[model samples]
Target: MSTIQRPSRPCKECQRRKLRCDAQQPKCGLCQRARVPCEASPAGKRGPKRGHLDALRNRLVQLEETLQNRLDSEQHPQEHAQALHYSPGSTDASQSTDFLRGDVGYGDPLPQAFMLPGPSMAGDADTLGLGPFPFPDLAVSLPQIDRGTHAELDQLYFDRVHPSFPILHKRRYLNWSKSTAKSRSQTCLQQVMWILATLLSTQSRDLINPLYSRVKQDIDLIIMDTGPCQLELVQAWTLLTVCELMRALYGQAWASAGRMFRLLQGLRYHEIDSPRKDPVASEGMIDPIRTEEKRRVFWMAFLIDHLLSIRNRWPICTRLPISDHAFQAAQLGSSTFLSQAVTEPPSSDTCSFNECIIIATLSGRGLLRDVHGTISEAYGGSGQIHIDHDEWLNLVLATRNQALRQRNDSDRMGTFAQILGQVTEILFCKSLMTMNKNSSTESCTQEYRCRVLRAAEKIVLFAADLTALHFSMVHPFMFIPLFVTAEFLYENRALGDGAFLTQLRSLVDVFGQLTNVNDHERSYLDLLSRSCQQNIAIMPATTCVELKRIARDFLEALEDPNDPTKAQAVASADLSVTHESYPSTEGLEQFLSGWAKAKQFMPNFRMELVDMVAEVDASGSGGKVWVFSKVTGGGGGTDRDSIDMMSINGEGKVWKTKDVQRITSKH
Candidate 1:
């Protein structure tokens, strides 16, 4: 075939560089000269399709028509007053404009996207910024620390603390007052001091010993001076009461710490006089002590609730090693009113620590269960509705029976869902505390953890907003659902930690409930419906894929019968080949499956696969590696703790590559 000689097309600069050109402006000439991948458009190419252009034009015309109609109505004195009643639909505002210009899209809007909810509502005192607030510099006015003071105290404390369940520390910036202003420095120091103190309080709660009592007493004395202490006192009191019940159940000393915790809980939400007549004020609101307080509470609640699950013999973890049977028996046999304790009339001698324990325990357990469900569903599924049809039917039956029983006993008391919701705040607060400070670069090994946290914070806010809505609507019926969602969100926060996308979806789902309520305010209902629909529609496709992968992992884990190491190894390799370290719960499960698969062929097989790693070295160069291996697996057999793989590894041992393991013999 004879080739027709066509004129070569090259932009001026590309011709100078003697380079083949895609022949485009802006990016063509310089990029071609640099031998870079030229992103310049090919000559004579048109931009995005004309359909988009036509759509834009139609939208503009429609908006213009509406505006013109509004202006025309305004300009005529005869119709000016009537214009107020003229709805857009009556004026020729096309439905397409409403549909096309629905609301803000999925991706973050530049600048405004980053602007935060606080700045958007800057005029309001109640609002706080979504991101970490910048700590103002005030150190110049502060007194210098003495040489004796261990300046590394803060860092040391963080190190000694149990690696917070999630690896990353919530981001918090340093705010020190200047030498000239010792007062501000003192204030900031006090805040940090309280935060650290509260964290230590939860740690102490777990100690469950005589030393714990003395330590808590002394700690209480110190924290009582801080602003958030009053609430902390309630938590402390609750912990102490629970401890006392434990002791009392075993015939130990009748410690009166229960009264202190009760007094504190009762003190919360009590209204205070304010010079500003802000109608929104409820009680002297519990200003978060340190950002971590709520998180600590959630974690504590999570632990306690799991304990309750074992106690109640909840079927979910029945296969796991826990004293579920013994717990259930004890619960049934106990006559000291453990279940009904909190509601019982308090005696003069003691407020019945048993009641506080039961109530707190119930609250904690509810939060944990809900959170587990949320995280499990979020991190390990295909966006499928988690409702087990059978489970829902059972729940309906149980709730109906309980509702009837409560009606027969005391009409004033809440329904089962309401009680669940009320107790959930305890867990939710903890989740908030843990997540409120997410500014660190710590590798998230659990994908769902971050997702859960993000969803939780948003959900909590959504619930709070909905609660306000219910109160505004003057509908008592809405409270139970609100509480249920709040509790669910609270647990979600604790479990997900800071998984932003997952958490946002969770919140959207709960907000969806408000939209369904007929009594909800029309404006709020509209905003919620639109926001939720938009969020769901625009959620990134990658997230859906990740969610599905996570779900698949969970399903595989649950279904696989063989606990063999070989089988697990095969599964792990299949799941985690793409990432070195497990980026999420799903990834971890995949690794566990790999280990199980490996054991099938090599009974003694044990392996660890760490992915998405960043190790800081002395010279600051960072390197990462991934491995699939076969090795010995040995440990104290129990599900309560993770295997100490580091301790188990022999010094100088290296894993060599081998044939990929498969979960089944057929493979």
Candidate 2:
């Protein structure tokens, strides 16, 4: 250099002395003065060392190798099953080091073809393999269940799940699943469907945990990366909601259902009756099968929204249209709802799906849950504290009857529908009973109690039929109905005949069967069963028989309700309606007075026992309850139901004054 520019970096000797560098490099003042040999350069390199890229490259190489193995396995997928479905492998967290770093899983000996590797990031992120969504790794994490396990699951799904929920088209889905190729969204669908199948098949947390966790981890990324307009995505989301419910992930289930509903709105599925050329009409070309699928898909979301509301008593995401015809048509096409839903469509069992819709709508409209302050406001309700009980009962029965009219010759779907319909009726009946517990007449209270018992019994018997047929045929939603029935039975067990505890325990046994699928159900079942066993009281056979005798005699006394003298003679010993004049059945006593009053107000009144409950007393003290469905003569067949509960002390042989509770005016 011309003047030997002063070196900016210090020499080794200067650094050791912690002094400034001199103008020259060969000899420095600090080294010379300290009598230390000076080094030519500094102790370290000119710049900081870089070890990050090296470590990253090593990781990249590992991923590439594992991906290559997966690729090789995918080519020969039939040979992929080197071991049985997830061979008993160690799931111990301490052995996690043995786990793969990708979607293959923690400790499962899963087939390598489950996961496929995405393209490596090139020079630019814009050119990444993920189409229109720069998330190159989103689709890669999806794990396609192995062919063998998938085949088993496919059979299981169509055989068991499909009968209850026939949302997917069978032949098309089977063909698609069998093929080696699937789009990004279809891949997502496969993964979620597999997750549901796994949960339904095995109770082993070992298998469910890994697959479920992987889906949960990658599914959000896929949904976010691949925007949610696809029908397959909607189906996947719905299935995921079911999965969350099975595992008792309530919060997550709610969120998943909510997201799916929004996706549905985005796809414009909610505009069922819109005049505009909506998403279904693409440039004046309509796909019939696809359109039917869209309707089923929308109805599926509708079903979930209502189920969520029913299960937790929460506000539904999408409010039902005020129009009944529109709502029913939207649920199942007008033609389908009329022909298939009511009569039996050769094409599909839409009645089952419509039946579920009916229950969902009933729960919200009937206001079964205690938390209806906000929900009431949404649907033009007065948002008042006291619900109009008559209006509530009317809505309930109307919905129930409409759903009941849905007939399927095949019980595969019909059984589930019947169970749900009865379950809903039971829920509404219980709510009515609870509302009128103390302030109302004993007879009125007992009428609702009888209704509750009848509905509960029907549900248990239907579930019994399902169990007998095959538990797999039961809907996944059956779990909710089962719990609801069990709880209602226990709460109102004292209202039953001598068979009170018998019915309750029958449902308890069904609860235990849920353990065959998983243990979560057993936890709640134990709590309910324990409570029932500890507190439940069974009515005595004598009291039940006596009450039945009293009911029969009362009906016999009023055999000619039209005749005044016969009505007056109801309490006579000759009539045998009440054997002992000292302890007369109140039903017999009220006959003359009610008939006389009926003649006074509206002439020629006719009455019969539409429904009856013999034993209303848990102490077996002999309390009589009967539900009289009133039919007004000469008035165009106006059908209505009422309850006349009579309080009688069998032990003391004394009659107490009771009032009539008119439950519903008309169906």
Candidate 3:
């Protein structure tokens, strides 16, 4: 069947070789002779052939155009607004574009998606750019450190500080540190690291003070400089806050933490991803390593804010928008990535340490959340509300269980976890104390006292144990637990036993040994020492009368001797096991006159002598008197001692008098 006569073309091979071709149907004659199958090129294809370099160049051109368009829109917003208003809204193909454009108005100037290096880029600083991060215009400049000093400081930081807080990525940081052309972000971070290392490693104020000043100046310069917040800068501020905390500069630390919180929110680190309608799908395509590091930084910021809030006794500034489940999922994903990335298996110590930190961080979040709730309930909103003790206790127990479940062989982390658990317990107990401070029922009052004493005991025991093991490893910032315990013991002198006293002395010694203890900490130590001695002195007084007498005598001794009324003899008599002679009515009258004179001179020295049996009769000649028992010891009426009182009418008034026989006579 003769098909329509077909137009013929040369085979592709013949055309490529540029040989003249005789029109053929199936194959050219040359291809047939050569025994080669031939094909013809398709018609109507007309475009420049694209190579790898050409494709890359095209992408670069496209990016440049896009950047220029963005800059132009920013520079001339009215034009952009006009364009947006004129654009068609109903086109199916334009829907995605419209949605993206909507986000452009609300999007952060420096989106978090651009914070980390891409998968192809190995280093963050290199990926960002080697130029100085633009800071606000400032006259002060950052000091530069030599490579050797930088390396030494880095090593010191990783060895001492990073072990406790592994916020920085070891491999990534090491790689960045080796770069010759460091950015301002990198310089700020290095300075903070040096400051922390020097602060922890040295007790010499002369050395650390200068280093701290230079670091602070650098931080100030960086903060004042104008640029989009970078991850490195966030990290620098985080470390700087930590350094401030180590120095017991709580106000400064809190302020720095607030700044860090703002920066983190600016970066949208508070959210797992942007809440914009047109979220970037490329975020999911980021390198797992970089994603993991970002997750770590976010959690670190979260933890720092929570811890600072707890320390400052304020509400947490940042709300955790991400759920715990999501956090756990991210943690698991990062762990999987780490496992895949490491060629050699991690040591058990390393695994345990990492697990301990992770578990502690998670549990600490829960604990801090409950603490915030308690604080809010008690002190926020309207007025003080009743703390649900059982609910708070259950929360503490749950957190403690979670922490203990993840405990490992690492002593430092394990002890720290335990200490945190005890701290939570103490906080809960303290909340109850605050709520029940003015409770009307005696049972409630007794329950509150018992709970407080128990919490105090637990705190002291946990702190003593922690101090015994790797005390030097304990951060001075952690001494809050000890401080709380000391205050409790001081207030409730009956709770301090010989063992507790000994442990308290040991804690003071540990505080002394800490290289990072600032003047605040030293002052706390001194106060704790004096409180411990005072409590120890009252330890021997078993009866309520003896306790009261000792306390009164101590207080009286502290009076200003220059005052005529306070010029009584310093009572050297041991009230623990001594009985004095009782005075006659005339002698008692003289003592009453002296007591009244003392009260007038010292407004703070009002003493109410209560009779244990019945109310003293004040009905004599238009005068009134009442007697009540005074219990100096804490807890529920365990040790009761009573002293009698008398009231005499003088100058149309009742003068309260203490019966000498009732005080000196054994009950």
Candidate 4:
């Protein structure tokens, strides 16, 4: 008969004494029989139970398999590593192991017998272990353990609590450990230092050392040198990017460092033209190549330091220092370097350098408006004297060309786009100021207004064309200046109102083109629209109707073929260029619809006729013409009337006793 396996019977003590007893426990009937006291013990408590035993067995089997595979690999050392696609997310164990073994493709496999040194381990090296590298200064020091002993938990109150986020202290240490490696922490520290350094340092060049040191450290962490050409190229590229970042930060600190902006460009020449003094190579090492790489990193930091100084624009002590002749000269030098970047074959080194220059230019523009009031006060009356249409065109063309032609070098091209915006803003502002000042001056003449108008028109048209051509890349930086110019032109009743409306209409029609691209053109377009609405809201209620009509008609024009040429005719031809266009029956209520609601809260709002006589009268005696609004009983009348338009003629008082001359309005 077949034997049937049944559950084990209860211990003999349970049968004889009528007490239940488990066979596997601290004590059972089997133990009692030996005169031992009985005690209960939980299952799987004393040692490895079934579950743990199974896990251990599996681990041992895996180890055995791994050992066998390793042995096979050692015997057949010539075996090639498997190449697999790497997704940023999912990774398998074999792939991970291969990565740890440095099995990444090295093209023409290195000899297996050659053993490269790794980060040091205990016993084989000193307390501060030395690597195989020759340069002691370049060697990175590991984070040190605190030397202090008997540290109380109270001392860690500050350590446990993050100053930026105190609530973080409530979480356990293990909970926050996963986030300690965040790049944001590094960025935050750098930003704090950057702001402090810019504010504290009186001399632009004085901040260079600290900036360069940080940049060098960053490069050391990111750059990996495995070969001669590849190492040199990457190092060069890193240096160039550092230079660009430094340059971007330069004009913000001090104007004096404007001269130093050229230093990075010159330094590039030094690094590239220097004699190729090859270092001695050691077996199983890339020491010689690494030395060159370090030099490249050092030079990059040096370049970045000066560039940052220039960006801060501290020396010039003016907003948008780019307008200064000296600043412009420095800009020209920067542009020269950027223009030179594209003509050469771009390696990793070349690409980064190009990027650096572009970023510097963009960053420098941020400092422009800081000096706006000073520039306006100093050169406000200079009118058409400062207009340079050709120069403006050149800057526009250069930037647009750089952005398009050097698409691969975005950092540099992006910087160029920013510089273009700055230069354009300065010109646009100067033109707007002239138009505002010349509005009422009979001596100013239509010829002068028209001349200024012509310049504004050309800039707007050029910007519009450039916007379409490189919308994906150039739009973000292009928007502010372009829209600012558009607003200014619209206020002056200049040529571009028609053109801008037309271009905008075309853009709206083909809006789909701006989508699905890497560029952030939509942000710029939105900024422009918002800005336009704000400026439009401040116009007289009568003009509101015509403005709305123009806006609506332009939007309507989008329904037509999105050809810019056709849109221009439709939008431009619709705007009434004559004085009759003013005082449209459409009131402020309709116009504000296109504007942001926050603008309605403005304390003062006025829209007056553009007059020329008032400007000449005020400007002739070194006074400023101010526009005023009057409330009429019949219809709300908004007209230009100058008040307090005289300067104190070497006197401390308001000087109201002078002859009050009234300039008649011809309109």
Candidate 5:
């Protein structure tokens, strides 16, 4: 520990710490006292190299020249592009904005999962330390939205995709994303929940396509993974099926649904319906909530299977895992079996996922099942099968009752439950009538005919209930069945009562006011509407109301034959005469042609007549009419006009354009 004369150069340790080194022979005094080895460098060993100043000057000179060149180019687009070097692995401008932002520094490679459906980092996989990046790949940058944004999506989902539909579990899924687990299946689930939320969100437009595409890629990887089945993956694919169905991608939805169902079977989700644990199965130790999730997912898939079958008019791919009418109260017997099928027991009276599944199952099996059957019974299956009329009626009634029961409960399910039931009965009668094309009224099922006519009126009232609400956000189940109801009403207009054509006309107008958020059944909507209008043009329509009900400064005519009929009598001060809203024969043909183009773009739109006078004599001659207003849905404000209409017994015959003339009218 002697303090000798200081060495010219300090020991490496002293130099590193900028401390004085004692420079003793064995070791620096400081190093020796610290019991550490130290090596002192020779003088000037680490000094600047000879001519370093000159090299520094030269480097500065080079930088000055480069700056001068850049300035001389003035950052021309092409010149700037050549000057700024991009990372070799950088891709098109479409890289995610909310994720993976900024330059990808060297060695900071994209995770194998994110790079999927795209190339990876610049070098060979081994060189970059990723090594083929492994299938059932780990670490994709699954959604990393801020808590606020994530929360908003959760709200969006619960708000729009009602829990009663049962595609996903809210609390479980949101918690899973926040979990520390980064397994491949976890990534798939996280990505799909993100996509579902994005698809449901109104403000997240840009995120949908990217999220959708990436989730699909993640799903493909999960399906190919050799590891054990993951419940989360099944759940992800269930939500994915919904996404596809929402976009009307039926083929993709079907294929995805099949894969998901197979995965569900692989995981033995079908057997999990019972609460008892199986001794030999790994699932014996599964979290109780997870078991509940499996059931929810199974029911969700069951519903999807029935939906696909109904939409396609084909047999259900999932088959009848349980009885089609397994919903019978006496059979199920106070079990609340469907109640346990969800994570939470349904919130009291609101229809649960089980309710939805039962209705879909019954509709698919009864009315639409072998839908081509007629007279003796041939609703479908190309008439190869036969059932007794009493048996057939029983089936229809069971489905009808179940559906009506859904409607009777709180509509917390969003779409009206009554819609499904009424439409089923309506379509049931429609099928019988359609199949019995050659049969007389006596040969057809009278009860079914009556049901069809009643439903035609009932479905309109059901839809009318949707006014003033955000119709676009409602489920497709609402519009799809409503569309079916409209078509049925149109075809059976002849069998309708006094108000039948008016009701038929009212239902037909729904085809226009109702804006299907998703482009579902797009192919047939327009054509069905045109045919209904053409028929209404030829069929007789009589609307009777007291004149006191007609409001001032409004014209209610046959214009906008597509707008949901607002045949409601307007409540006004004057009680002069009765009112009727009818179209001018002179304008009906022209109105038909321009319906789509002239129609207002309103999502929750409906139209109601405000003021009018029906002055036609019992002789049914054309007459002059006066002013009225029509209250509209969705697109705000009223359509006020003055019109004089003319008509006759135009039923069952095409009206020539010259048959009626436009009388004097003022707006």
Candidate 6:
């Protein structure tokens, strides 16, 4: 009975082309001629189209209904008995509520207010084949260590790991451990501590996977439940991240770091207020110990986030949100506490490990923040950023001085800080090199190269000394220095400097110790060792003597004849270089041309004549116009034969040169 709608006008394309249309079924005659399909205008809508507003309105209505239902259930549970029914496995409601409020309970379910997903509905056939959802079973059983073993591991952690991190309050933690039965949070922490201690003390991965999985599972449950992000929870997760990093599970470590970052944010730890004035604490209760602990935990999170950001090449997440005054106030408060503790009358059993750790942490934080800021400023601009060489050098020197001071004052902790400082210098130098590589106005100069090589040498010698001292329970931070030094040595081996080759061998030896604990370490060692072997394969016989000597020293240091890889490196080093030969003047010219094209020729390019040869025709009518010989004279470790020959056309032009085995004979 309704009037029919009229057809719409033709499409814009046909109109634009000024084409006449017979407006056929799917195509017009003009469009058909042009081999383009005709598309008609869409029919006009009678009303406005549905869009985001409509969807939002629908969602709001559903939420309103849900709220109404929830209120009704609260008012009269009998009205929605089936909906509010508790499963047999669920804990008492009061217990769940108390646990949600952060009271100690192991079996309580998360409060309903948190809005976590419930267990799968058995009565619903829709989700029958999807399998059980994660986090339904929050219960986890952890492996228990004996009392003696626990104490030993705790001591091990304090002795080795605590000096570097020092976030945990040993006395308070020990007292708490003795006073209370283990809670879920405490259990998770214990597992993490044990895993770290074992790794540091034994350098063994026997307990790593199982313990790591257990802690991970617990963390997942806590996150899913939207549980209170307590300090203990934060510490547990932070340690878990460290453990992941130690195992070279970078992706997993990064994920853990992200979660830790969010957890700290949820706790408002980044607000940077004096702990005594923390708004989240009770109105009148200002527990200085708790305040200090919170500050320590926050700083730890900041440090971890910064390191992860650098490692992952992502933007840092721990940017201070509060004013400078607040940050200084927080730092000052911690420093005051540390100073008071250290200046107190010393007992025979008193240990200043805690104070040393706090000072070192504070110093390291300041240094790292400065480095991060400098780098960000250097690279944050739109165009090319030119580094002030003097300014850069001063910064490096200052960092080095700080590290040396840290190293000179204390024992292992100082040593740790010292190594970190050295690594910082190496990182800065590397940054400069990278900037130079990418700079339009500036290129890598000899001075910068020398700085990098010097930094690398320092790192290598320090690592070698540390390894020789058997202080090889090396922390995760040390890995960067080791890896970077190896990379620098490998890439610059063409310099033909015996010292560079020697350091490279030493780095390889240091890596051998690390390979047993991490797959990444093992992989890196293998790759670098192979690279060294490859360089050795093409090295000139004249340069082989020093490299062979270095290789023998490294092999002897290994003290294990069964290590096939080290033995193979020794054998590769022992390979005799074949006789060298020099090319004719024509070949030299050809080499120069190719070298220019490759951009391999530097301003200081030096060519050493290793060999020369000449041949004459039997009739003596044709002179020696072509020559082939080996030459090695680049700063970077390239050694190859080259060909020099005169033009076959007899134009009498300059001699031409090409790389070994590349150019073919024309006649």
Q: Alpha carbon lDDT of residue 212, candidate 5?
A: 73
**Clash count for each candidate, listed in order shown:** 71, 1, 10, 46, 22, 15
Q: Give me the runs in candidate 5 sitting further than 4 Å from their true place.
A: 1-144, 274-286, 310-350, 367-389, 392-407, 412-415, 434-446, 471-473, 490-504, 518-667
Candidate 4 local lDDT, 1-667, one digit each (tens): 4533323554433432233454655346455564645443323236533354565566567667655655554453232111111233453566446534645332222222221222221123232232222122233221111222102221232232121111111122223323446342233233223322232222223334454454444433222222212222233233234233323332322322222233223223223222332223321135322332233333343334433333332222111101112221222111223324423333333333334434344334423433453466687633333336434443543454354344533332333333343434345345444445636754544444444454444444444444344332332223334445545544544334344343333333232222212122222332333345455322211221222223323333333322444335323222221122123223223222322232334324332212111221221111222222221121123333322222211111112111133233345
lDDT string, candidate 6, 358-442, tens digits: 3343334444544665767678743333346436444545544453554363444445445554555555555555556656644
**441: Cα error in model 5, Å:** 5.8
Per-residue lDDT of model 5, residues 550-587, tens digit only: 21112232343454232112211121221233233233
Tens-place lDDT per residue, model 1, 381-415, is 43222346324333433343343334432111122
lDDT of 3 by residue, 539-632 (tens): 2222222223333333344344334233233222211111232233333234445444544544543223332222212321212222343333
Q: TM per model?
A: 0.19, 0.50, 0.48, 0.26, 0.51, 0.50
Quantify all predictions' global Cα lDDT against the true fold: 0.32, 0.52, 0.47, 0.33, 0.48, 0.48
Q: Judged by lDDT, which candidate is best?
A: 2
Q: Worst ten-residue run, lDDT, model 4?
A: 315-324
lDDT of 2 by residue, 480-566 (tens): 767667666656565556465567756655553343344432323433322233332222122443344344444455545556454
RMSD of each: 30.6, 34.9, 32.0, 31.0, 26.6, 27.7
Ranking by lDDT: 2, 5, 6, 3, 4, 1
Error of 4 at 411 (Å): 12
Number of the predicted model whose TM-score against the real structure is largest? 5
Deviation from native of the Cα of residue 604 in model 1, angstroms? 42
Off by over 4 Å in 1: 1-153, 160-229, 232-264, 269-279, 282-390, 393-667
Clashing pairs in 2: 443-645
lDDT of 2: 0.52
